[model samples]
Target chain A: MPTPLYLATAVAVSAAVTWGLRALPFAVLTPLRSSAVLRYLARQMPTGIMLILALYTLREVRPTAWADVVPTALALAAAIGLHLRTRNAVISVLGATALHVAMSTLWPA
Target chain B: MRGMRARGGARDFAAAAADTASVGLSLFPLGISFGVLVVHAGLTWWWATVFTAVIYAGSLEFLLLGLVASVTPLGQIAVTALLVNLRHVFYALSFPLSRVRPLGRVYATFALTDEAYAMTAGEHARSWSGARILWMQALCQGYWVGGATLGALAGSLIPITLHGLDFALTALFVVLTIDAWRTQRDLPAPLLAAASFALAALLTPGQVLPAAMALFTVSLLIRYALRHRAGSPAPDEHRHPVPAVPAVPAVAAAGGEG
Candidate 1:
């Protein structure tokens, strides 16, 4: 086991670095917020970024197995459908999540 | 006036809390998993608390357990963190940090996770106060930290059958993506995202996320340049009319989208 001092140092380093990474954009973007480039990005990037994030989250869901694909697809459809119908994010997330958890448990893939 | 202000404050708090309930439910289970992992990795429960409180970034915190257990070099940890979280730079492009108070903005910036960004993005966030935003962020952090602490303390008692709870994050992202797509109706955005994911997955499977983001950024810039050359007005120009003399600063407009 590492010494207590070393462990403390590790935690501190991790905290500082993590916090710094989170803070970097804010510091860098404060000055450039008004630039035409950022303006364009502000308007155009949201949809693209959200898309990227959703796909990225599902990157590991290979289609080799029905069990692997079915629950997630169904849950995603449920989420979309509920959101489109209710226009409530909380309901969509919760309802879909409950369905996913139940499906995963029942199917046991 | 004071009574009215207090009531307004209560209303904002309630709204912010209500808005984050789904996220809170999702994060708590994940946080518990993180706590269990930290302890399993040979660290104390307090370490989980520290990680949750100080780092606050979910995926990075998960990775940190292994890094700490292996005693990875600080420089390596810092570099890994920077790459893992590089997407936050993109999030900052449209995050309404400017609307928040200065000191609150600092904390807001620190707490701006993927869930927080997703919750606050699009048209709904435009009318949110700095108070509501800050409150929402604080509640998120609270859920994470509280859950981590609980897991660390009673991790052994928790059953191992909670297999698919992690899907909550993915589901939340899907919902947010749908919301964003509906709000913007920008068809090429999803296509570009797919193209970026394909390129990144094919070329750099290990680093698919960052690679995908970089590819998307480049593709977006190219599309923007093309549109500019074509003299097409911005899609959002109608929603936000530019003043004759520039009354609102660019930063104010930066919060308009993304």
Candidate 2:
């Protein structure tokens, strides 16, 4: 194992950098709170960010070919369908993940 | 503490825990994998808890697993953390930190993980109290830390080795995205996000998130400037959806969201 000092440094640097990024907007925007741009972003950014994040989450699913991408695409369709019908977060997430795992594992590539 | 005389106390903590249960379900498996990976990566079992408890970002922690094992330079590790987490800066824009009190605000900011951001900032949760926000954050960390610790300590015994389990988070965000759409019905915003990502992938494929976010932010700023020029009321404190949280008062509904 690496020394405790080394591990502590790793944790500290990662934590500091991560926390710094999270805190940046809050610090910068605090003074700019009165700015129209800031308010406009508050109205607008959340939805766009959430959409971007959803797409970000899908980054791992790269398309190699048309037919190769069927299962994962089906899983997304399943998730959206379940969510629209039920409006239950738990059901949609679990159902989609279950389909994804089963297809990815059982379906032949 | 004022109007909250009727429905209030530690109940907020419990309610937040319940609020976090769905996401907690996702975190547990991912966290358990992290725990298992930590021990398997030649780190001590306890480091699993240390990473989750301290660094707290999911993808970054996973990246750090490889980095720490390879003895990556500190500067490189810091850069990795910054790049991987740059998306967080955007989260602060709409996060209701202003409504949260001082000490709790600090904790809220510290724990502003993607899951935390989605949970608290979702349309239904706009009126969340400072205490509820804190408790939600604490509970989120608890689920992660707890799962990681369990996985590290008793990993092999758990008998779970599912592939594609990480997709749960993606699925969670998918649901949240749909919910955000249902809430606001903002078609252009989602289209803009897709276009931003598409453009980012076209240009800075390696740094899609930060690049897309920068482009998106600039676009939003342009929209704001145009709207301002068009005389749609300049954004002031009372008019804007204020992000400058007060340093004092208003925990009255601390436990009142029942």
Candidate 3:
């Protein structure tokens, strides 16, 4: 097997493990009747998680490739535009990704 | 208790479900891109696809690329992803997802994604049909499987350029944020999000996420504080009704069984 294949295997395994961890709360918590505290905590989770996810992704992008920021910004604009007009998630994400990709390919590095 | 939507028609509901499936389809590129990246880092497609289908969380999926490349132990990777996705717990609290057709815990948690969260978050605001929610998850997962598979195979066919992949997440967030802003009338949300993100960006170092989380936490706290002082409005109360907003109810009416 190639070196990439080894990495792929690790990734696949990691993904599985990660998914299992995520599913734990739902499996464990969903069945149980929740207390006020449980409910309160669950309510607070998304924004923090989402912020972490988005910021984490941005951190990896090289700061000097500031030009790359434009396509993503445009993609966000496209996603918002499509979503507002259509109220559809698939279209919004796809349109944004495609447009962003196209822009990246076209933009001078 | 809000049961199934009273006005949603079967056809519209199906259409909406189909629309959801497409969202998953979009995930295909992401998944495949991830798979290809992993393989390049030295893994196989099987492992890549499995992870894409199994782990399924977008941010964590990317993060896994780094962990795997560095030879991090599986246990360690698991622990980190769990911590990263810990925030999803909050999502299930208020949304209809916790009530989504119980998929034996594993499937429900495995399938959660930003798109999944966004879709279900909107659904929770309106009703609690576990079946509809499950349909969305299943469809999204399907796209993930297909996308990863194709991406792994095409890894060689496509040039090995990583040009625009990184920005995809930002675009996705921007899109979702805008969508949330337009649908609801509450100005506090976007305003708060902007203020928080900007401040977080300024204070954060090379890593923007923890900073963003700080901002998001502040926004949520602000909202939570407001709720305590003003009493939270009914979900529908925050919605801005366009004078002739037949579209809102029309979409819902055509989309439900009840």
Candidate 4:
């Protein structure tokens, strides 16, 4: 097969898998008519997914970049604060991003 | 929460559809980024657009870009993409969009991006509305389309380096995780994800995120299994009826969808 064909295949397969996984609750719940286990999982799904994603991102940071950590920590704090105070996703994200950019620029290593 | 209105009998499917459209439109930039990346990697813009329109999963899109560039074997790329996106299975499993009309259900499945999933699931907790769910999905797709177009048009116009942008996905995920943990009140979940990610990172360096995600997913499974073995009620036993799914019109959901 041509190389691009390989990528296309990858995209197709990935979409299928994604559909299957994401569709799991629907397929099962529609039949089962409300699964407590599944519901519980759903409740916590965001947290679990986010945690892994966040850690993965942080892990990529060079461990020695203490300066980077400062901005990151600031961003996290800003996000947390904005979320708690305004409970708004857009504002919190923007605020955190702005803070991080400012800090990084001001205190570049 | 000004006009937090609740309608009981007749379902406002049109309203929901409109809402979904707004979400998709807002998210077009995300899709555009993936589109730009795909074309930049030597693929045709049409293919890139088709993929964004079809696949519609952000992280997996980025991963697919890599798999495409390396010219990995078809079978291998397929498996990797499958594994990388395995978490989506869970996303689909518990989404409340299925509660919508069959047509809405079909559309929901097609439009179930991460943002939509988050919004819909949160809304479902309060009241299951086909309109609201549909709106979220549509909006998410909008973002995908917008993002792809922008990326394709201005692939090089934005001189900002792409080096740290990938981290945005990670940061976004982190924020998502934290929010999930805060809302879910389930200790095992956040802990499981963290532990799994840490272990996977140690085991696999470059592929840490995927490996960690897979491991984290397994951790959740194991926790579920252990709970099953013990025959104990899982934490989220009672569905707290959400109060009209407060439309926090502000929280501009961020992160490059791709």
Candidate 5:
């Protein structure tokens, strides 16, 4: 086990770095808020970033494996369908995740 | 005047609470899992609470438990934290922080996790108050901190059969992506996202998150340059005139669900 001082230092270091990243934009962007480039990026970046995040989350899934592929595909479809129908993020995420867990348990492939 | 102020405060609290309910619920299970992992990794329960309270960056905290267990160097830990969270820089580009008061903005920055970002990024975020935004973020953190504390105290006494709970994160992202897509109706962005994902997955399998984000940003800039040269109007040029909110600038900065 590490010493108490060492543990505390590690936590403090981690916190400082994490908080720095979070705070950087607010500090830097205030002045650049009116810049055309930042404005354009603000308009164009969200959908692309969200899409990238969704795909990135599934990056580890191996296409050759049916076990990983099938449930993810089903859950994604369920999420999209539920979201479109109800327009509620909570219901969509919960409903889809439930379906995914159920499939994983039952199939076990 | 005091009575009116009290009434407005109560209304803002209600709005923030209502907004946080779903996101908070989803975070609970993950926080419990994090706490359990901390104990299983030989850390004390309070350590779990401390990490949740201080770090507050959801997935990174999970990774931190492992780093802490191994007695990783502080410099390495800091670098890892930076890489894992570089995406938040992009989030700041659109996050609705300017609406928040200066004091609240400090806390809002600290609380700006992926889930908080996702909750606030939608079209509905246009009308939120600083109070509502800050409270929603605080409630989300409370769910995480409370769940982590509970799980730590319970330790291995809690059943270990909570399989597939992590998918909540993925499901959350999927829902947010759909919402963003519906709002923007921007085809090229999604396509670029797919292209970036493919590139990252193919080239740098282990570091997909940052790799994909960098590629996506590059792709977006290229697309912007091409469209500018072709004399095409920007996507939101005609349909959605910019909102009159002084704080809002060009679709706000890119905050996402962590």
Candidate 6:
């Protein structure tokens, strides 16, 4: 074993887990198709979970640090604003990431 | 009969390629960036190919690049994978896998990536075949894997170490949040999410992700019950076509057998 896992094990486990998640909805679609509760969840969970997931990614940022906070906040705003304007995921995400990367490297956090 | 079958397959292949060309062009560069990031994070180049080839979940793979470099417990990795990929479980609600011939369903489901789903599961895909959907997904994966391999090969030869690269994941989630909100025209859901997550974080301290998801799920169920009691279960503002365009019906169509 490669300590935590053999290299192949890590690959297989992640692959298996991902495949299982992707396949799950279809596997159970017969029963799930008629459930109103599941229907509500399908409508509700994406936006809700996505918001939480974004926050989870940023959970560690220190709210008090001006240099980091300013850029991080601005980057998020720019991302959201740019997406609203363009309705394009690629431009908004890449453009915001590029702005943050430049700031972190040149402007310095 | 043979000639017609051959021609239909060819046309399906070409149409799928054309439908995916623009998306594929963008996927290539992002895949390259993923490859470069993997090497910069000190994982071997083969790790990039193995991950893109096998796991194939784009953002989760980025998260895993960090985990694989550390001694993060395998149990945690499994949980993280579940949370990150949970959205796909819903994508299946409207994904055209049911239209796919039974034998192809397994591979089709395996490759049901965000890119693949976005391309294939929409109002326009009503007439698409299992073979066409399969091709679109395979091409998307090829572009991703090819770009990642190229990026790793080139990245390994260079000495660039970029900090704050992890910000890509944050940017990605933000994009998804905005899309999910726009698709549903649902503003309150995100507010409820913020509240649920904050409560979970404060109350549980550890186990925030799963705890928050559970809290959010409960909140959704409560909201659903109230709406049902109130009569008519959908928000009024959601009367506008769920998609501004045809490309985003997965959530809107989720309440159906289609």
Per TM-score, the best of the predicted structures is 5
Better of 4 and 6 by lDDT: 6
Residue-wise lDDT of candidate 1 within B111-156, one digit each (tens)? 9898888777656666788899999999999999998888887765
Clash statistics: count for each candidate? 0, 3, 21, 39, 11, 0
TM-score of chain B of each: 0.86, 0.80, 0.71, 0.69, 0.89, 0.74
| Poorest 10 consecutive residues by lDDT, candidate 5 chain B | B249-258
Residue B141 of model 3: what lDDT? 75
Over A11-30, each residue of candidate 1 has an lDDT whose tens digit, in order, gives 67766765665666665665
**DockQ (CA atoms), all models:** 0.47, 0.53, 0.29, 0.39, 0.51, 0.51
lDDT of every model, 2 decimals: 0.75, 0.76, 0.57, 0.60, 0.78, 0.73
**Pairs clashing in candidate 2?**
B1-B251, B1-B252, B98-B245
Q: Which stretches of candidate 4 lie over 4 Å from their true place?
A: A1-10, A32-36, A65-71, A98-109, B1-36, B39-48, B123-125, B156-163, B204-258
TM-score of 4: 0.73
Error of 4 at B256 (Å): 33
Best by DockQ: 2
Arranged by TM-score with the best first, the candidates are 5, 1, 2, 6, 4, 3
Residue A34, model 2: lDDT of: 50
Winner on DockQ (3 vs 5)? 5
lDDT of 2 by residue, B39-133 (tens): 77878789999999999998889879998898888899898898879989877656777667666666777899988887765545766777888
The candidate, 1 or 4, that scores higher on lDDT is: 1
Between prediction 2 and prediction 3, the one with superior lDDT is 2
* Tens digit of per-residue lDDT, candidate 3, span B183-247: 45455544555566667667765334545555666666666656667866635333533211112
TM-score of each candidate structure, all chains considered together: 0.85, 0.84, 0.70, 0.73, 0.89, 0.79
Docking class of 3: acceptable
Error of 5 at A48 (Å): 2.1
Give candidate 5's whole-model lDDT. 0.78
Error of 4 at B117 (Å): 2.0
Candidate 1 docking category? acceptable
